[model samples]
Target chain A: DAGVTQSPTHLIKTRGQQVTLRCSPKSGHDTVSWYQQALGQGPQFIFQYYEEEERQRGNFPDRFSGHQFPNYSSELNVNALLLGDSALYLCASSPGGWNEKLFFGSGTQLSVL
Target chain B: DQQVKQNSPSLSVQEGRISILNCDYTNSMFDYFLWYKKYPAEGPTFLISISSIKDKNEDGRFTVFLNKSAKHLSLHIVPSQPGDSAVYFCAATYNTDKLIFGTGTRLQVFP
Candidate 1:
């Protein structure tokens, strides 16, 4: 069975531009979550989508938004990207809603130059 | 404000030695804690976890200890091997859906 898969292994974007990263969860998994890992830091939770709806969110601003499709895949969109937006965007999938072990994808490296 | 904190940025240990990475959180409501390991250019992988009900949980050479009173948790790797070297992150969840992570601790095991 394949693990979580993310698109565009690496990307480069300029300031004021918007970017969308995609994720397909692991087989038999239904929940999807997004995280941001800055250089030399741990992954920070962005939001979680379950049952095709956002179930929980972190302290991120409105510019960071996400959507979950019926098939349990997810997309993370960052608008008006800034230089600080450069980081590794990771997608994780789990079978249940809460306290479930997560399977993570290699992540998409976003570079705002 | 950083709720979860891993003071030590990096740790180095000789092979077959014990390595202990510490983490502390200011949030008392957090009841579930977990540790994840990450290699370069890879996503963080779940290592182990402990609920507030248990003070310790162990899996092979990996163990996680939770001290609720002190709001601290630790991951202990016994007989550390070179392959075990990676960045370790401490995460906590209050309601179990969203997790808050601390700055990771990079572990280097010398052969």
Candidate 2:
């Protein structure tokens, strides 16, 4: 069984630009959650998607949004990137319904210059 | 406000010794806690978890202990090995989907 997979292992964007990161969940999983890990910090919750709908969100602003497709894949979009946006964006998936353990992808390293 | 805190930025232990990593959370509402291990360039991998109802949970060489009164949790690795060296994060949730993670502690087991 393939684990969670993310696209564009690395990305570069300038201020005021936008970027999209993609994620494919593990087989048999239905929920996808996004997280941001800044340097010397733990992964911070961004939002979670379930059944093509957002189930919950964290303290992130409106500039950060996500979409979950029927296939269980997800996309995280960040608009008007700032220098602080530079971090490792991680995607994790679970089997849904109060499942606590999450399988995570290697993550995409985003650098806003 | 940082809800979850891992005060130790790094830890070092000799091989075969016990390694203890501590975490504390400010939210008393959190009922579930988990630990994850991450290597460089990789996402954090689930390690073990403990619920508020239980004080301790063990899985093979890894174990998790939670103290509800102190709002603190810890992860213990017995007979630590070099491969076990990685960044460890403790997270908690209040019966909700979103998890509040600590800053993480880098553990190195030297031979």
Candidate 3:
């Protein structure tokens, strides 16, 4: 029973480049959420996906988007990245429908240089 | 506007002592509150949570107390251990599913 898993633990991209991070939800989980954590700050919600569709979104711009596959895995895509985009992108999974506990992955550390 | 806030940037406590981390929210609509613990280079892990219907919730050494009247909440760790040292974040959620997080409080448990 592995918990949420994320790929490309660390990445480096230049300004204006696009990057995609991946996440596999925990077994039996159907909802996936994305968050961004800057250095010395807590995470800010980016969006959430359920039933292969985006159910809720935060105050992020269009440059940040995500998708959830039928297998409950997710991908976060960021386009036209900026230096401020350099942060830890976290993926959390939970059981859909209610206030289930969220299981988080180690996260992908993106450094826009 | 920041809905949730953890004003304390850091807290230091000796081992075997108690640690109390505080949080406040400006939104009265927030119905659920959660606390998460994070270490460097890792994502946050859920530590505890409380719903607005309850004033307090406890699990082992960790306890979360919510004061709806004051729009405040606090996490108390009794007999703190070195492993408890980490950055703590307070998050709130309204009827909508999305969660809003605070700036976080770094806790240092000295042995």
TM-score of each: 0.97, 0.98, 0.97
For residues A1-113, write the lDDT of model 3, one tens digit per residue: 99999999999999999999999998999999999988877788898999999888888999999999989899999999999999999999989644335788999999999
lDDT of 2 by residue, A21-77 (tens): 999999999999999999988888899999999888988999999999999999999
Model 1 lDDT tens row, A12-104:
999999999999999999999999999888888899999999898888899999999999999999999999999999999998775456888
Give lDDT: candidate 1, residue B51. Answer: 89
Estimate, for each residue in B1-111, the C-alpha lDDT of model 3 and write its tens digit.
988999999999999999999999999999899999998877789999999999999999999999999999999999899999999999998774778899999999999
Q: Which residue pairs overlap in candidate 1's backbone?
A: none
Model 3 RMSD in Å is 1.1
Using TM-score as the measure, the top candidate is: 2
Backbone clash pairs for candidate 2 read none
Task: Judging by DockQ against the true structure, name the best candidate.
Answer: 2
In every candidate, how many clashes are there?
0, 0, 0
Q: For residue A108, what is the lDDT in candidate 3? A: 96
lDDT of 1 by residue, B44-106 (tens): 899999989999999999999999899899999998999999999999888775888899999
